[model samples]
Target: MAVQWVLVCHGLVTLLVVVSFLCGQWPIFQGTFIERIHFFLTSGAYDYFLRFVGAVFGSKCSNAVLSVEYYCCDRPNPILQIFYLGILSMTYYFIVKSSFAYIPGYYLSGIHRYTSLLAVAVGILLFLLTSFSDPGTINSANVSQYLSAYPYDNIIYAEKECSTCKIQKPARSKHCSICDRCVARFDHHCGWMNNCIGERNTRYFMAFLLWHFLLCLYGTVAIGLVLAGRLKELRVVYILTVYYGIENSFLGLAPHVAQWLLGSYNTLILIAVFLAIVGMLLAGFFGYHAKLCLTNTTTNETFKWQEYMSWQRKLNEAKASAAALRASISGMSSDRKPLLSKWRAFFQRSPLQDGQIVQNNVYDKGFVHNVVEVIYPLSSRPSFTRPKLKPT
Candidate 1:
């Protein structure tokens, strides 16, 4: 079970690292854990024993206060942040879902797409919340007054680390221990996303989420449609369906979200079709991004590699990129390093390997819902075949 150990270790480490980065409470988790070892060094029980022993030696008593922000992302009210984390805990439930056969056109087996669809709804929420127009539209006088003070439409800076750095919060800044650098507009750094979700790529991230959720949902329905079509030939109940049922299948669709937006019959069908198509496209996107989020897919992955090509290699490709780059230079490189050297390094890493499969795999089993699933490359890949879900 070396493979299992490796997977478990990777999962624990990655999850802890992510949780640490997101929660900023490594000390707490670390300390609270392995308490027996820490007792002699930091625990009160050990201190009492030491003081008792030192009573004969006349050890002096001292008092100090230390406050720790544990598990709550070091925000002003971390307890609230934990509560929010509970709400935002993403599940691959949509993807793990069973098919409902009673419905004529219902879909199944494309959890990856359902995840994309779910992410889209989330992206819209995040984008909209992030979308206020500087509040300058309402007051020109305040805007003009502020122009001399700050003088930029959208300006964000990384506040330098210092004793007072805690108070001098910078715009879109997060202290990343893994990178050991502060990222701007710090969203979560996913092992899946492989990079920090900062100011530069938050939009893409949200978009990825939106696309991923829809993709999973679409594939779910589409797979169901195909499965339904095949099952019709046999005319068997497909016993699993009797329990999973048609009503619960509605969970795959953002029933509330769709209903709120689409009121017309023709419009609803159109919306449904559009959602379905988007979901299909999302399936493709998730197939791509599952490698991405779990492994280090980047913007360069788009337009350059089908998989996770390192930014360095992508940079090198860019230097030689007369043929590789887009019509317009988006200047999307994560590293501002020289492109030629980056290209050389990329070639060195993989001489014949064309695309990448960057980042590590995390196979944590406790809870995974609506997770975008990828088919491991195998001897055979038949598209129309009904698939089996991988064990958690």
Candidate 2:
């Protein structure tokens, strides 16, 4: 019973940490403990650690830690890439060590041993493709091509030059300070891949996300089948029903079966739980990126649009306030009239109600076109080099 409780608690904590880390900043989670946990996991914990180091050691040691952090986070370093590989290898190693002997058991086929390796290899290939591929870097020679491909919308994107690169910046291109280069159709830089996700390699990055999700799902289901096989081979369920006199019905037998599995295969349960949580997270992340691709938007564009909408809303409110004041003054200066009834005043619409702001995304060329654009970036097409001809 104690062991079962411990496993339950461990699963709950893992789920909570994963959820908080991934979604603490979301509007739905705002002002919740999940948000606080997210803050601690992402930044607060590191801050406290740094303070502890500074207090315990000297300033020189603290400076070294800060320098390591700067290189790992603010600059283009392979720390996360190496970390990702390490985790992947270690997880596979554990799975093989704990579960491989039962691979050809009753519920699972022998072929899974090879298939699992292939799946992981494919996932790593996708990762390498995303990590090493050019993310549509805009350089001096091809700047004209990029400019022709993406015209300035004059709203979020305006006709401007990149001060750092000294080149005309195309629409949707952003200068990545970490990479120290301008990327066309820029998405956020992924620390895991240690590369910017941009026009050229967005497809690869998306594939990496989707494939890894499937891989985790595969592991979870495979491990579950292995555990189920163990139960069958050991006759644990039948023995419980026969010798222990437990009821055969699911509700009656569930607790006993659970306790048996918890006692016998706790490691497998942990691995399955971990994989399930990670799979769900990857699925959600992939869904979000898929939505962005369908809508012809980037993570950076989302922030830009939010800022634009906020500014527009504030401007509209200011104008409404001025209009209301002017109307009040004009009414006061005019010949006196009967004041409106309280009921009439109560039902009257406020001028500020007109302050609703809508986002206008010119680059969203419709669903199919948007998806195609991501799959085959405009700059990759030959027609991208051709500038629009002026009217005769």
Candidate 3:
């Protein structure tokens, strides 16, 4: 019940954030009560943004200056509202993850299992779709129109000279404030992205987006449920005055969230999709990370470790500390050496490897090495038989 409660809450928060983001991007509610409210708050500086979004959406909104033809729903054919609404993510993460989690203990850890991975993946995909897909490119409004409308349009690509960057600029592409370059698949000026979106970690970066988004959406859903339950426990709206005995009162902890996002299938399905997709994306990302760790391939050195420095660093680190101690005392620093050089040395000199010396000065005597195969190394070692005396 506790776990179930948690999942429910997460779904709510997930739905709201996605809805709000989509609303800003697509303004589906134009001419509706909510749309009027948005128009009022965003009409001044945000007029152009509002209009471009409006044009893409075929809704009525004012115009602005300087624009780029990004943020189009350039999905294959008719892009459904469900995609932007994040309904896809909700289903996968919630149903799939909850099912997987209920199956006894995590085979490894609470989160390292399939359930968690699935949850994370859904989050990643939605983020990619939103972050990678350009509003301008996908929108039909010509670049000139977008340019005239978007006041800050000059910064779109910053007069970039790159072949890979979008012609009208990708959704999150920015003229790297520092790199003096346009990041192809930029998310943010995140203190990290390793090296601009080249061949290696574009996938991993996408994975990162998926997992992080999942984490957020999952939290939203979990919290939303809790808030909802609280709300139902207390009647709301018109009943508020009667229930509270106040003329016009607010501030009951029943859960405003439930009122905002509940009792609609389109919404319910959207939330479910967000959860489900997030779960799968997470699973895939972590599995990839695990494989990379086991195989010793890093994000930077994805396909190959071309740099001599990386190879040297890896070789130096690979030698067990025992080898380090031996080398340090013997005045032989293994730094900057090739991997094979040290690999051959370990088998030749180390008693631990040959089965003669079990544990000694080479490594701290108490150290535990070859623990599983310790018996083999000891028994196969030369026997300590009392030598037969020679009869001279």
Ranking the candidates on lDDT from highest down gives 2, 3, 1
- The candidates, ranked best first by TM-score, are 2, 1, 3
Best by lDDT: 2
lDDT score, candidate 1, position 345: 69
lDDT tens string, model 1, 1-392?
45434544555565444344333432555655444334433455655765665565444432211122122222223244344334233322222232223223333344544554565466545433433211111122222222222222131222333232233333324455443444432445543333455434444554655645654465445544544454444443343245435332446434532332233122223333434544555455445555454442333323333333456567656555553454235455444644567667666743224543343322212223212212221111243133445699
For residue 257, model 3's alpha carbon misses the true position, in angstroms, by 23
- TM-score: model 2 vs. ground truth: 0.95
lDDT of 2 by residue, 277-299 (tens): 99999999999999999999999
Q: Distance from true position, residue 30, model 2, in Å?
A: 0.5
lDDT (0 to 1) per candidate: 0.39, 0.93, 0.41
Clashing residue pairs in candidate 2 are none
Across residues 1-392, which tens digit of lDDT does each residue of candidate 3 receive?
45444556777666554443335334367566545544444454366566677678555323222222122211122234345335545544464444333333322234534555565566556445444432222122333333322223232223432354344633223344333444322333322221344212344454555466556466445534433443444445546556655455345523432333343222443444564555555555556644443432333333222453455455555565667678767666445644566667666664333432111111112323322112122112343122335699
Indicate the residue-level lDDT of 103 in model 2: 85
Model 3 segments beyond 4 Å from truth? 1-17, 27-101, 104-174, 178-201, 206-392
Weakest lDDT window of 10 consecutive positions for candidate 1: 370-379
What would the TM-scores of all predictions be?
Answer: 0.24, 0.95, 0.23
| Model 3 poorest ten-residue lDDT run | 356-365
